[model samples]
Target: MKITRRIHSCVEISDGDTTVVLDPGGFGTPDNLAEVDAVLITHIHPDHVDADALTAARATNPELRIYGPEGLRELIDADYNVVADGDTFSLGSLNVEVRETPHEKIINSKELPENLGYLFNDTVLHPGDSMAAIPDMEVVLVPISGPWLRMLMVDEYLAAHRPKRFIGVHDGVDNDNGLTLRGGLLRQLAKDHGVEYLPLKPGESVEV
Candidate 1:
């Protein structure tokens, strides 16, 4: 399978002619949602779900399917298939499984909606804006930076899960210096665990 990392948490995964899109929010600028078979959403935050982009994506590709957690249907204007924790579905040849995780809490913000983690073909886990104890998978999308994250929290999570490989996401807030600093640390951690760590720039693609 091929995974293309977008600006923020958005990523496009493809196997043959089928594609799965995830989190086309503030930092994500997907080249083509028109060909996407399944679009998985983790939460309803603006930076995590771009309503305008999705609305336009559906407009261009009327058959493009959308999926997410409960109550997310109210936030989005387009039609979507809801997938809660422990739910599993299919998109072409890939098996899509859902796992619930805690949305990183902000001190002053209101309670957030449910956050979902998606596991595709049992290979990759995209935990959206979360840092929870997700099941072991070969590849993982780790949040490198966020409002509710700390350096230690990230370090601990990496050490705990220690997947075969991890790609950095949720990094729109990071400046060059911060990214470099934190990325260096993560690289070392991955090296220690004998895992591959990719801090992919926007538009970069990797095979899994």
Candidate 2:
């Protein structure tokens, strides 16, 4: 399988015959979805869901399938598959398991939106905006920076999963310097936990 990191929390995963994109939001626009089989959205946050871009993509490819929280249905006019916690489905060659990971509560926020993490083929876990850990994962997409994130929370999350390989995500808010500083610190911290941390810039891919 190949995992390509996009800006912010977006990731494209392809398993030879099928390609799936996750969280193509305002932080970054996904490439044309004409050949993409499915899209899994974790939440409805603007940074995680670009309504205009997705609308255009769907207009271009009406066969595209989109799945996410029930709240997402209200945002986009297209048909959708509302998935919650414990939903499992397959997108061509990709096996997916959905875990309802609550978005970390932001200080002074009235309410939090629904969030779900995707576990692909039971090997890779993408925890959208949460630090909620999944066990026995070989690879983990960890959020590095956001309003609800703290360094201690990140440390605890890494200790819990202890995945063999981890990649940082949800970092579009940072400038270049912040990316380098936070990513560097995260690399050393992950090493201390006996995990290999791979830093992927936007548009980079790594095979797993």
Candidate 3:
């Protein structure tokens, strides 16, 4: 599978025919969402769900499947699919498992929605804005720099999961100080855990 790391937490994953776009929000472009077969939303944060972009994408590809946590179904209009924790679904050969995430730091207590982290094809895991126990996967997509996750937590999570390859996301847009600090911390943690750590700039693609 091929994964392209878009701006912020957005990523486009494809195995040629079927394409899955995850968290296409603030940093999403019209061109980025053009050929998407499915949309996977992790949370309802502005940075994770751009209404305009999503609408445009849906207009372009009318048959797109939009998947997210349970309550998310009411927020987005379209032929949406609800995916709660432990829920499993498939798009062609790709298998997806949705897991719940804590919204303690990322969102307000009252406004917090059920955030989801996804395990893709049982090979790649995208811990969408959450600190989760990593499943067995070849590549782990982790949020290395974000207001919600501190350096200590990131370090701890990395040590615990210990995947073969780690790609840093949810960064490189705002809060330069936080990004730099987390980047440095992630590098150190990667060395300590003996895992490959890759931090990609927006628009960069990686093959797994």
Model 2, span 1-208: residue lDDT tens: 8999987999999998899889998977777555588888999999998988887788889999999999998689898899989989998888999998778888774587899999999888888888878765788999989888887887887787788888899999999899878977898788878888888988899999
- lDDT by residue (tens digit), candidate 3, 104-163: 475565466678998888888887778777644589888766666676876787677778
Position 68, candidate 2: lDDT: 91
What pairs collide in candidate 1? none
All candidates: TM-score: 0.94, 0.96, 0.89
**Candidate RMSDs in order:** 1.5, 1.1, 2.2
lDDT, residue 96, candidate 3: 92
TM-score for predicted model 1 compared with the true structure: 0.94
In candidate 2, which residue ranges exceed 4 Å CA deviation? none
Please estimate how well model 3 matches the true structure, expressed as its whole-model Cα lDDT: 0.78
lDDT, candidate 1, 94-181, per-residue tens: 8888999888887765787799999889899998888866546688998888888887877788778777788988888889898888
Model 3, C-alpha of 172: deviation from truth (Å): 4.7
Positional deviation of 83 in candidate 1, in angstroms?
1.1
